[model samples]
Target: MTGRPPKRQRIEPRFHDGESGSLDMRLTAEDRPAAGQRPNAPRKAKPANRQNASSGSRSGPARRKSAKSRRGKGGRKRRGGNSRLLRFVKRGAYWSAVLGIWGIVVVAGVLGYYAAHLPPTSEWAVPKRPPNIRIVSASGHLIANRGDTGGEAVRLEQLPHYLPEAVMAIEDRRFRSHFGIDPIGLARAVFVNASSGRLVQGGSTLTQQLAKNLFLEPDRTFSRKMQEVVLSLWLEQKFSKDEILEMYLNRVYLGAGAYGVDAAARRYFGKSARLVTLNEAAILAGLLKAPSRYAPTNNPKLSEERAQTVLLAMHDAGYIDDDQVKVALAETATIVANRQTSSENYVADWVMELLPGYVGSIDTDVIVDTTIDLDLQHAAERSLRTALASEGGKLAVSQGAVVTLDGSGAVKALIGGANYARSQYNRAIHARRQPGSAFKPFVYLAAVEQGLTPETIRVDEPVRIGNWAPQNYTRKYRGPVTLTEALSLSLNTVAARLAQEVGPARVIDTAQRLGISSPLQKNASIALGTSEVTPLEIAAAFVPFSNGGYGVVPHVIRSIRTMKGKLLYSRKGDGPGRVIDPYSLGAMNRMMAETLSTGTGRAAELEGRPAAGKTGTSQDFRDGWFIGYTGQLTTAVWIGNDDNSPTKRATGGSLPARIWKDVMVAGHDGLPVSALPGIYEAPVQVAEPAGSGLVPPGRIGDDPGRPILPEPGKGRGPLNLLQRIFGG
Candidate 1:
């Protein structure tokens, strides 16, 4: 026991039966009379029986002899009474010895239990583990539990009176009015054991049960019983009756994968503990003994029978009236297991996988306030489903992910995969597919940095950068095209020449500054998205252009709060150093705006908002991509089969663009209209390329915050420091 008392005596013995002999046949000092009185000064005559008649006849025949014998008989009779008393005393001594040993064992066991488990007053026996429950949202009304991230917690004083009464009736009738131990009930249990010829029966009170559940060993044993009594007494002394009752209700197991009454309440009735009816409470109470076998979720018939037993107990305990019993008997428990069916199924696995990454570990009751806008998440899902339906062919897809962020780099909505269950291959955060033509903007940014404007001339005709012949998507070159037209039309040949002109090294440097972590090859085809990249990398890379050419990293967790509601840590938005000149960033935005306005993304034109976006259709259409953003929000969409096979007739504009538009429309429903945070001016006046039809350039914005140029040897700093430590 954690803190229970030793042992208790049920019945106090009154007297000892230790006498020597029969009263009539023994002599005693009392029969000799007092010192001043005569030794046999005539004993008081007693009412005589049949034996007395014979005495009278014998006295007459031998009057003298009889008188003498009678004189001696009084003393003998007195001694006889003393002897009988002595014998009774001896027998009483034997009984006392047996009772003493029994009492000592009981008391010793109780004391040992009390000493061992006396300190802990709470539910110390439960496994010390991180809670697995993840509530999607916050409940406004209740104080949350320790495991409750956003859910409710019920307190002791708030318990409905009927809840405890039902529990008391179902678990242990004599809960109160005991000093943490119930001797009478134990005796009765002993009788029951004797009748059944087994010791499975017990008389552990509710307090004892609570004590056992909270702190002591679970093994059914006399020693455990002693410990339970000790712990129960200690708990009773420490906590109030109501508090103990509440703990019992909230901590008791109720089967169906539910722990406390609150979880059970939600699982069965699709509601909170406060709303459960008396009948519902009774049904739950019935599950106290053998929760699995009697659970309403598993066996309704047996559960009803058990509930009736609880009701009858309650009626006997005078807790309910006749009508209530009748009604309870007639009612059936309608328990729907896991009321939130399929809700947790879709997000649980993804959320769990991310839990550790967000907090650097997942073994705490850390509250993760995600930027997931449930509304946009729903819309993204709906639009994708609609597009899939239009295809009329089931896509051989294992997973899908979407990441939508506001213009300020705040992730608005995200779904890691369609079902985070079948496989937790979070494509939104993990998969690295080639960006195809989607990477052209970085090439444009590189060109602008090297004194090249959007209208800078480049040939879209067949071009050979070394051995690779970069051609247009149609394989037929468009001859000469301005940079603006090339970007909009996604002409591959023009982009390849621009990268070659900027020198492959500078282009690679620019991609790195834009927060693309994957290695980029120093080849001409790099402009055509030959390198692999994740969607998150693309979103994060675009954040710089969105935020006036300042690099910003993407992060999900804002702050971590402990299970006890203490703040542990937070993620501040400090990323890798600034990249891209504001002037170049603005020029790229202008070109992308044109791309959306009248080019490949002409399908993306909204009602009145000015938007900029790009479309990417890789070779064989293995991956379809659309990276788009308004002045307010930025969203990127990619759709393809996971097997890297062609999505039949699917283009970035076909389905991905539509999904992107739908997601952005829902995600940007609120907020103000602000200009994109970039330079107001354009590049310094430059000669327009032939057939470009470009607008005249304004003065260039301040040439500050250029992409951090890679050091001569990829920084011999931290990487070198670790290398030195290991001498590797």
Candidate 2:
């Protein structure tokens, strides 16, 4: 049957272990029988290597962790092993790993770091930017002292060579050579803080100190420390040694509201940063730790003591010779209080209020070229100080506000109040009070625009409106008068009657067009200055007349620059809306000019300069304003109580006008004349009285010229005022 192959091997499945099987093809070397004898027989399994086998699983024993390889094997590093900044922050995780592996890393990586460090950093080539600075007259009530904002910053290398030596001796000795990140200093700080349980001291490096002063918070947290360290290194790589040092020197706080060494020098010695003496530098340096506590103004004894300490430190550190230290310690100002402030800061606070929205921040080293000339500001401050001093510098309720704008509407000077620091209310720009007769020019201009000439006549008789009878400041009225005389004399009755004749709506419109941003009443009583307005608005509204009717839009920021010296903003020189006819404006200008020459604002007339302006005295003597312009400058002055209480005999021509005059004298001392543009003298023509064969009463309809009628009740106040003026 086998021979025929047909009788078929009975198909049988067998287990390989104990029975002949079809699946097992292998036979052990010695266990295999000859082919003929092993045919149809199962092969024996080979012996296993028991030494390397696991208990049951097919995988080998865990031999991946070879003793030699496992020593430093995983490649993960310790906390601060190889990071760029530090391990305290998660961002430094990668850098920390790199530093830890440095010992065994490829030569390539080590070479890379060294190569990155090797290139000489490019010089800090940031261009300087002209700072957008604002000038303001200090207010009588708010300013602690009246002084103008000016002067240039000081450079570090130019600091009396002894200056750096003194600073190093007093602050930190090893500031020059160390890299920005000082590990030893951090360790010392850590040790001290750990022992005290409270952070009592920090041995921060100069770079760290700079970091704190420039960008970081004042806290001493681990994360902050890491950021400071990394940022300081970055700064070191970015700025030149001298440039960084200079920035730090000029920006650091020196207390007493004196920000930098330059400000301190001026505050202490009435000198520029470049002209400070060795003792002055020592005194300024001593102000670093706690400027207010040791300022010479509040405590000269303490300030002198601190200065002596700094001098001794400098001498011991070899910053100054023994002889120089002795001289520095012995130096003293003849009169410290006299050195407190050269001028009052009445207008300076005004500028501060108007400046921020235009420039944003005052922390940078921006060079602001203000419209104010410091010499002029000083002159104005001097005059006010002398006048007020006679009354103990607290004339009446004791506060004043002043404003000066160039023909271009650039504020040349400002004084918001008498004591800027003690009383912080900025009366010049922020206070809104009745302008009284001062609001007449705008109403008269409206009349001129509405088909009436300056020669037009109106009865200056007393009139009642809804139980409200506004009397003249003198409680008397001129019978029939030209519009010019009414404004020049600031007659309340005539102004009210004129407001009625011109349509109060038009008066409000005229005020708005001239730069009055406050909400105006619709009632005609506005003609008598019944509505409230700010001194800033009064000053700005009059600017068009100064510019010869070629209106100038009031703007503070001429231009803005970034910290890195990029231009961010620049004024477009847009002019104010041309409201009045050229002839009408010129006629009004002549009368206002006369107001200074012979009328109420006679105080405003300078000895050598041709001046023109008006005086406004509100009810209860609560607000007083004198606004005018000269050949070179135009200024506005306001005197009032900060609490809005009535002043004792305060009037536009009294203290306020004098401040304007003083500011002008100082502000325009040497400036060339800038002739008013668009001026044209009106032809003299006799105005026909009303009710002739000419126009009769009410003949002129109450027509608001070309108004884009606002929805009912929108600015209803201005609209209502217009109705009252129309005798509604």
Maximum-TM-score candidate: 1
Tens-digit lDDT string for candidate 1 (586-648)? 767778877777788877666566677888877777887888876667777877767887766
Model 2 has an lDDT value of 0.62
Candidate 2 C-alpha RMSD relative to the actual structure? 22.5
Clashes of 2: 64
Q: Where does model 1 exceed 4 Å of error? A: 1-154, 158-166, 177-258, 263-368, 384-393, 470-473, 562-566, 570-578, 594-605, 618-620, 641-646, 672-728
Minimum summed lDDT over a 10-residue window in model 1 is located at: 137-146
Poorly placed runs, candidate 2 (over 4 Å)? 1-156, 174-253, 257-275, 288-293, 326-330, 333-364, 385-395, 561-566, 603-610, 665-728
Mind giving the per-residue lDDT tens digits that candidate 2 earns over 1-728? 44754565675644344332233333223353644675657666544642333454221112223322443443335423656345446656766787767744654454445435432435323333222232222221211222222333566765677666666667766667667765676687789999999986667766667776666678867556656665577678887766666766766677655556766666667665677777777778888767888788768888888888888888887777878877776778532354333333544444455556765656544423244545555565566556566652344646666666766777655555665446656666778888877788888777655545444567888887677788876778888876667777777777776677768887887788777888889887798676888776678788877765545655543554543566655667566545544545665676676677767788777876666788888788888788888655667777776677887767787777777777777777667755443333323223333433222222222222222111122232444424322225
Highest lDDT against the true fold, candidate = 1
The predictions' CA RMSDs to the true structure, in order, are 16.7, 22.5
C-alpha TM-score for every candidate:
0.67, 0.62
